[model samples]
Target: MTKVFRLKDLDCANCAAKMEHCLNKIDAINHVSVNFLTQKMVIEADENEFETVMQEVVKVCKKIEPDCKIIM
Candidate 1:
């Protein structure tokens, strides 16, 4: 399944790129995008594992940018 989320406090384009890079490394993720300009994120993953993948995504995002939030 595919999902789009709004991001809060995403500081810079570089950070957004970092988030995208990390998220794409996850095995379950098929595609991911982090857009600093729009403050949004898009993720495509297996439907069955999406929730678990998102939990990991949140952790990854937090590690990179503590103040960043992905609105569920």
Candidate 2:
């Protein structure tokens, strides 16, 4: 399954890249991308595990940018 999320207050492009890298490392995710210019994130992962994967995604994002939020 694939989904796009709008990010709020994503501080920097480097952080976005880092989050993208971290998310793609997850076994359950097929792929992931973060576009700092647009403050958007795209996630492709197992449909059955999408929710759980997203929870992890949030954690990763939080660790990268505490003020950032994924508009679920």
Candidate 3:
């Protein structure tokens, strides 16, 4: 399934890029995009494991930018 989430307090475009890269590397993820200009993240992942993948995505985002939040 594909999902779009709003991000809060994303620090910079570089961090957004980093998050996009990390999220795309996940096994269940089919595609990922993090847009600093819009403060949003788009993820397409295995439907059966979507929630699990999203949990990991949140962790990855936190690691990239401690203050960043993906509003579920």
Please report the candidate that would top TM-score against the real structure. 1
Off by over 4 Å in 1: none
- Candidate 3 clashing pairs? none
Candidate 2 residue lDDT tens string, 1-72:
889999999988899999999888988899999999999999999899999999999998998889999999
TM-score order of candidates, top first? 1, 2, 3
> What is the C-alpha local distance difference test score of each model?
0.96, 0.92, 0.91
Clashing residue pairs for model 2: none
CA RMSD of all predictions: 0.5, 0.7, 0.7
Worst lDDT run of 10 residues, candidate 1, spans 11-20
Off by over 4 Å in 3: none
**Residue 66 accuracy (lDDT) in model 1:** 96
TM-score per prediction, in order, is 0.97, 0.95, 0.95
Tens digit of lDDT per residue, candidate 1, span 1-72? 899999999998899999999999999999999999999999999999999999999999999999999999
Q: Give a tens-digit lDDT track for model 3, residues 1-72.
A: 888999999979999998899888998899999999999999998889998998899889889899998899
